[model samples]
Target: MRQIKIDYRRPNPVPQPAPRPAPAPNQGRPPVRGGGTEHPGKTRRCNRHPGVHMVLAGYNTEWNTVRYLCPMCHAMGLPPVEVATGVINAYFPEKGYGFIENGGPRIFFHLSDLATRFTPQLGMPVTCRVEANDKGLIGREVTPR
Candidate 1:
């Protein structure tokens, strides 16, 4: 003779929140007035820096919510170069280097471009950004769409 028993004390899992809508042509905020270094309700600042001004409103693919891309970050307290004008002089594929004609020495780019559709042109008017990483500067998404 054989006997078998089953226990039923385990609790049901919690339901996660609903995800946001995506696959949008342009789903973000319009440009605000007086876009500069100072964000809303911030005491610390520097007048010299005019932090990065991004036109696109980003949604965190991870959290699935719309979050603004700060030109710099909160740690700096000072603003970033929100508005920048320059050109991509060369793209050295062999050396994994890129140069900006008018931008400074730190001005370089590495293309792990997630936005695969974005094809950059050399010596073209590039109104984009360089995000801060461990290596220092990394170019981000482009604008004027």
Candidate 2:
């Protein structure tokens, strides 16, 4: 013979507060006009340096983003030259050696010379800043296109 006891108790339902009435429309203040129309309360600023009013130096169509020269970044008298474009002819990731097709003698580059956020790939279109030395043109700041 076996005796078993079963206990059954229903759980209580949670109480919910009554729904709030809808707020009256037009409670917010009207926007004041001073800055550009694109952003009502916001003003145009340097993309690199916040709080710096950007000056219209030029348009960069390739990047599709406006270029801004901050006083702290472009304090030098001379502006940087345009970046040169070429296909990466070869790249040895293990050895950190690479070449670009710049229509001149084989342009040599090292992994350290590439942009910090960029990784060079063989046959990838890239833009670089070049400097000439006795050996040949050395590519620096290599970035993919």
Candidate 3:
């Protein structure tokens, strides 16, 4: 009978990967919109919904104030900003989408954004509230003037 060698030594420890370098402060972060720095002490509560926290939406250049939008109010189709007057720049009845020229920039709107049951015509004046989404600015609660 052949006798086998009995090894009782512990195995070597596995090598670990090198620690990743720490990222610089806000290095990869996207630039803040509205061209203003967030103030830590600024009020975060929503005006309409006192219990809810409002999101930093944008900066009002004219008013020199920060604009905040309440997520609840926005979800309910409530205007986040003051009603803006614009004219229908483009419309596609089949596509159900259009753009409005409101002096600063063209605001995109969908047919469902209309407040009344009326066909939008070219150059038609409209009042709408601007809202921010993943795709940038969009007009909501559009009302024909």
- Top candidate, metric TM-score: 3
Candidate 2: pairs in clash: none
In model 1, residue pairs whose N, Cα or C atoms come closer than 3 Å (at least 3 residues apart or on different chains), thus clashing, are 51-80, 51-82, 52-82, 53-82
Poorest 10 consecutive residues of model 2 by lDDT?
7-16
lDDT of 3 by residue, 3-121 (tens): 54433221321212344466577565432222122321334566579899777786565423345688999999986554355679899999998998765556889999997898999
Task: Give the lDDT of residue 115 in candidate 1.
Answer: 30
TM-score of each: 0.36, 0.44, 0.47
**Ranking under lDDT, best-scoring first?**
3, 2, 1
Best by lDDT: 3
Q: Which stretches of candidate 2 lie over 4 Å from their true place?
A: 1-82
Candidate 3 C-alpha error for residue 44, in Å: 23
How accurate locally is residue 116 in candidate 2, as Cα lDDT from 0 to 100?
67
**Order of all candidates by TM-score, from best down to worst?**
3, 2, 1
